[model samples]
Target: MKMTPHENTKQFPALAPGPPRMFAPQTSTAVSRPKKNSTACLACKAAKRKCSGPDAPCKACRSTNTECHFDPSRDLRRKVAVKRTIQELTNHKDLLESLLSTLGSADQLQFDKVMDLIRKKAPFQDIAHAVGSPATTFGDPQELSNASKLAILEYGENHIETSGNGVRRPSDPGNIASSPEEIPNMKPPQWPTVSPYARVTLESLCDIPLFEVPAKPWTKVTDDDYLVSHLVSLYFTWDHPCTQFLDQRIFLQHMKLGDRRSEFCTPLLVNSLLSMASTYSDSPDVFSTPENVFSRGQNFFHEAQKLWEVEDDDHDLPNIQALLLMCCVFKCQGRVKKSWMMLSQAVRLAQDIGLFDTPAVSKKKMLPEMERVRTITAWGVFNMSSQMSIELQKIAPLEYPTSDVKLCGNEDFDWTPYPRSNKITYDKKPARLPEVREGLAELTRTLVDVQNLVSEKRRGTNLDELWRKAQDPFDRLTAWLQRWPSVPEIQPNPVPQVLLLRIKCLQAIIHLFEILNDPHQPQSVRQARFYQVKSVEETAQCLRIHRQSYGLKHIPSQIVDAIQTGLRILVPQLEESDESRQAFAELCRFGTALSHRFMQTADVIHEIRKNALHLGVRLPPEVIAIFDDPEQWRSLEP
Candidate 1:
């Protein structure tokens, strides 16, 4: 029943039979299969369109700015998840509110405190991890006062554990210690004739054989362990100023046991410390039997000297520390030249060991404790150097922080005290002992510059030039005073010798004033006199504090001489009348009494008074009192 081409089309079931019109139906082109969509997104698949638009904003959804690549089904699931999360967050907020309502006020405060501690610890913990530093536990309330900038640095150091190089440095017993034959920058005394006492005193330190200070080996010392313990305790408490780094805990720990490791401390160090202790001890148990105790101290010092001369051990830290401590003993006993000689060697020795390395270089190579210990020890040496320079009327050999070896740690200047660990940890904050010594040393450095300026006669340095040169140092001193703590109980345990620091600062101030050399202007003279009196008052205040805390019996001869020298300068400057004479008389009387208390200092005063008289300076009646009525002065009590 197929229809023909055209004639039979009508006969065949109408037009339905013939082939469909070619144009209307289109030629049966090959069916083009669509390629897979390049952008595979749920949106493109749902719409069944080719998404020509780039990643997120496909052309298919451009009008709505919809995520054309997003899967709607997955989007519904994400929406549900986001809603669930928001609901959970809202529920958590409500729970927090409920907790707040239930918690006590105290608990709330505790929670806040805990949060604060965590906040404080977080950044520091990150830093500690990077630097490989130990972090200090942040719990102390007092530590809060320190400025935040400092807290970051301080916390790391507070927890550091210092390990040693494990090298033991003991001075050989057979080696004789070298004595300083000449002091650099020191001018020999120009005297008409040497005083009997000055000559003898000098000999006692230099001419050891003449004084019969027999060489006693440290092991051969008197076996009175009780006395040694008492003396060592006394030194740590009273005399270890500028020498506090040789750890007392470790030292005592080792002292308690017979098997002390060689790396800890040498016999020379022990003898020197013990010697210094006995020298500074005013306890009746030690001092009542003066000859035996004092002699033993000298003998121990001689043993140290024997060890100090050992060339092989010149690089030893303990030996250097021993020498530094021995200088205090010499100073205590009025052997200043001997002290200067020994201290000069120590300064050189320290420089040799690269103690002056810059902070950046030093930190990378050292563990925490060794760096700190070296710093403190270096400070102690620098302090002694400054003190001696001032005493000798010369410039310090070691410069201040101007060197490449910059001081490090606590840059925020956290003055708050950390817990004392009995032994030294380099990073310990509020290191009061070192700080106090450092204060005086810093002050003394300023004084040294001024003293050197005033003492210079070769270039004929005029007073006007000196005054011009002095303004900066004076400004620095003022700044130091403004920054220094007046009440020095910054650290509570094992009270630092702050009074000693105060005394030194005052002495330095007095020396600064002494350089003015009796200016002609009345206003200038009045101000100078006022400052002189102020300096004396400060000295007296410090001495009073020191006496209350530690008895004056062990007070160094240097202190007595300093006071005497201050009085001597002040007495001549008062109004040239009745009140002036009385003040001068009182000062002379006081100075004489002080000298009598420390007999060795009397000799120093005698030399000073003689020098003053020899220079044709008119002597007052009060000045005549000590020299004319020697017995009268000797009979008086301080």
Candidate 2:
């Protein structure tokens, strides 16, 4: 249609081809993101100013004419990498210590040399800084030897003592290093395989019912109601004497098939309950081997502890009870440090709920149905915390000067009143439970006061006041025991309860004379002899009661401690007579029974047998079997 190219060009001779247009892609909205505060350049951060980016000639750096650079912490990859390194090092340190016990002296020396080489050449300085242990404290090889460094790593600062030549010593209770607060602060490391927060949400956990009704079919735990009922009954009966935390009727009602809450059931609560009940439950087949039963979940207590949300459990009773029960499990397992830490938390939690208040104040707020149970739980914690501090020689739970939480009575409802005309003196007829529980509360408080004074390792207080304060509790306890059987609770099955109180009283007496009795003070030797003899008689009586009636329900640390104290006192007297030898033999047998779970007590007995055979006190044959090998304690199960 166009004329020939030339002909067309002639018609529009001045026209020429224009430049071609090209197609371009459109920009995307998908890649857009909100602006974030950029990490400041190191120089800018030092000057307290902002940075545009870590680029060459960044805005601030350009303005200040300084080179732009990133802070070491600003590298996300490095931060995570370093944290993992710290955790790995910490874990390795623990693993090495545990394995060292299995190694021979020669092997240990070889391991020490290897550790020394590693510390000198490895990147420990950087790792130490990363974990918050200052490099200056750990950097120089001369400053800390490999052994010292390992001690610091394994137990943290508070668990070891440093000698002048850089050797390490086990922490002594007399030294301030072994403070009670040490264990409370040391936390087990978290690993990826065990996330306590797994499968459990924190948002509604504390406020929600402890057992939420499942909306679907239940399957995680067994649906065997018979087992559940039996376990529930076992726990209440065994534990109720001490804490009385759960109201049996209310708990049973809540656990009914139609009324049950499943979603709220926590693994630790159920596992701890089962574990504790297994220790006392009558089902022989299920609990034939306690070690097998307790170790079921393989570090279940640790797992349960990980799930304990201390910050959120201020007002939650069930979780608090679970915490206390976990403490019992630890105590039963001879894990003293863990038990004390758990008890500390339980006490603090009780404080948060104002359960430490004296009876007068708590009564004003408590519901009538809940009054007796709550009061008993609070007082139980107080009783436990006070005794633990005494035994451990630590500063105790801080409470209001005056007692506020009330004691429990037989009624399980309110404190029963006495006739106004009746004189409630101890020498008179047996007092009702209200009066007896009051005495028990007083005894606990008084003993705590005695411990604080006697355990004063460094204080320059007068010896006379300490002695007087210590004797006051003994006098009061003696008077209380004289009148104690009048109470209905003590009257029916009084041997076990009386022996418990008597053993505790004996412990206080032993601690008084053995620890704080001044070597040079006038008549100190004579007074100590009297107290020592008294403790021996009491311990024998307590053991006699256990054998005759209750048999034994898991020997407690107090019993172990009392027996050890008797052994210590009797050591000097063994050369004096055959009577002293008889007393010594009895104590050795007790030490054997107690050492079944608590190996430290066995170690004490072994040391006595090893170093003090010249004392002429022969250990029993059964004890010698165990001393030959501590592992044989399992054979003493029956």
Candidate 3:
């Protein structure tokens, strides 16, 4: 307060402010501190504590009285190791691509050779050489370990086709492509695909269960997987066209996948199929003993029977199939009564499953192929029961199925050529079209009505009423014949069902005339004597077709029943003329020729002889000789 302005300015000159100097306000902002670059000591790193620096004992270690340690080579970030791993993976991927390209361009023979070597568990170097790779490329011992090579060989061995000698040979050169130049010219293999109506087939195949022969269910039939495969294949080749109740593709797919839980295949069904197919196989194991041809397939039949008795699902599709096949086995073995009973049970089960109902009303959801199978199976039961009823002169247990199921065509099924043996050429499968089944079903339905009419006649129904009832069925049959013209001759035609249907129609027509021209109830519709003449003429025509037909052994078993019916009508006319007797004898000889293979045909010959004697009709010496020869009718194996 006392000092002057000049003296105060001189004393505090350093603190003197400039004229109107402006200062900005300072605001506090939270800024994070930068991370330290110094590495931690071993003790600090292990404890996950902060360190001062790498000069000596770090602050953390010094505080804890621990020694400080650090290795310059240690990479705490692991960046170098990650980079090495990525490089190795890239190299491995490149190697796989190169190998795949080389293999993709190899011819089939060369590919097969390489695969064979791999299956033999050859060294990786040898395999690489076989695949046409340069020795130096994969020559490093560390590239492929022996264990890795063995693993690859194990995978290859599982898929290779090993021979009976337990060695896999290279594929036949003749069967493989010749030159790599032809690769561009090669066409894709033509495999069967699902029809438009059966779009669900591909899905069904994908849903198939894995195949395991050693699994519990399959072991109940046989331990040998090959035996099961062979028998199943033979059934499709020989017996499938005869009935076709089961869908071959679906059934085989289930078997191939080895899923025992699949609804399509079961031990009962497989064993039953084996029983039926055993009749056609030449294997000694199919027989109970070498001396007993009659015992053929008995082992499989017994196993199937045991399964059938224990089967829990009475309404299942495969169960119904097993029952039907069992019926056929009984028929083949000449157990007519047992066959009829089994057929009755199968019909009842099919009904219980509501197979006769429309798919919309069905309780169980199904695949398209399974729906087709059910439809076909329903028709099969009806046709089979109706046929047996006519042949046995009894009433059919099952009625016509009312479901609006579309009949399947050949395209609905797999017609892959079947291999019979180790033969190079496969047996050509015959065409079994749905049209044949349609015609047969139409013809069979009419015959069933006619059969009912015959039964009523035997029960002492009014002749006029019976004849009036017969007119409708007779007209229906006549119309059926015109729609399906009879085959002129039985050459080696593929569609034998056509010829077989014609024969059945002719047989029914003959029966229709027999009822119309009954001596007790005569009508003015046609001459009674002409009925006998016409019947004989048609019967002679059937005999001629049967005698000349090539590959009679391969025809459907139902054809045998048709022949039996024709023979029954013709046997009574033997005494009418010598020419008739000679023709009958010739047919008998031809039939006996097939009897050794088809036991049912032999039963038919014996029944004809028994019926002839019952009718007191005298046979010629040659006809009697044909019947008397034990070799002709002997069911025992040769």
Best by lDDT: 3
TM-score of each: 0.51, 0.52, 0.57
TM-score computed on alpha carbons, candidate 3: 0.57
Candidate 1 per-residue lDDT over residues 508-626, each given as its tens digit? 77667666655566665676677767666655555544433333334543465466666566545544555444444544554554443343454445555666667665667656855
* RMSD in Å for model 3: 32.5
Instruction: Tell me how many residue pairs clash in candidate 1.
Output: 2
Query: Would you list the C-alpha lDDT of every candidate in the order shown?
Result: 0.52, 0.52, 0.61
**Where is the poorest 10-residue window by lDDT in model 1?**
207-216
**lDDT score for residue 217 of model 3:** 56
What's the lDDT for residue 616 in model 1?
61
Deviating ranges (above 4 Å) for candidate 1: 1-219, 242-245, 257-261, 282-296, 357-364, 401-438, 441-445, 448-460, 485-496, 518-530, 548-551, 556-558, 573-599, 605-638
Candidate 3 lDDT tens digits, 1-638: 69885685463445765687578788765667986745666677788777776777777777878888864324323334334333443434434443564457524654676678668986554443343221212323443343345444544344333368755455544534455466686564443422112233332233221222332355364676655666666576556765667777677777667677887888788888888877765456676533334456878889998988888774388888888899998887666889999999988878777766433244677677777778778877877788777767777646667544354445443333233222234335444546656766777778778888867888989777876887898788778867775545433443445555676777677667666666654453445344544544554555455445333334446556655555665687787776667657755664654454455665566567778889998888877776555344322211
Worst ten in a row by lDDT for model 3 = 203-212
The alpha-carbon deviation from the true structure for residue 622 of candidate 1, after best TM-score superposition, in angstroms, is 13
Model 2 lDDT tens row, 1-638: 76884675453444776687786787644656867555667787788876676555678888778877776444333444345345444444533432342233333533464466456764543222122121111223342244345544554534455578855566763554344466567544444432111333232132222123331122124454444445554454334433444544554444444432422234546545655654443233233222222222223344455656432443356566677778877775546788898888877777766676433343355555566556666766777777767767777745642334453445432211111112232122221334434555777777776767755544877776766666767686667656654233443344333455566666766665664567788587678777777677656655654544333333433466677767777766765665666666667666755543343454466457755676666555544664454334323322
**Which structure among the candidates has the greatest TM-score?**
3
Q: Show where candidate 3 strays beyond 4 Å.
A: 1-230, 357-365, 405-430, 489-492, 510-549, 552-555, 575-579, 597-604, 607-638
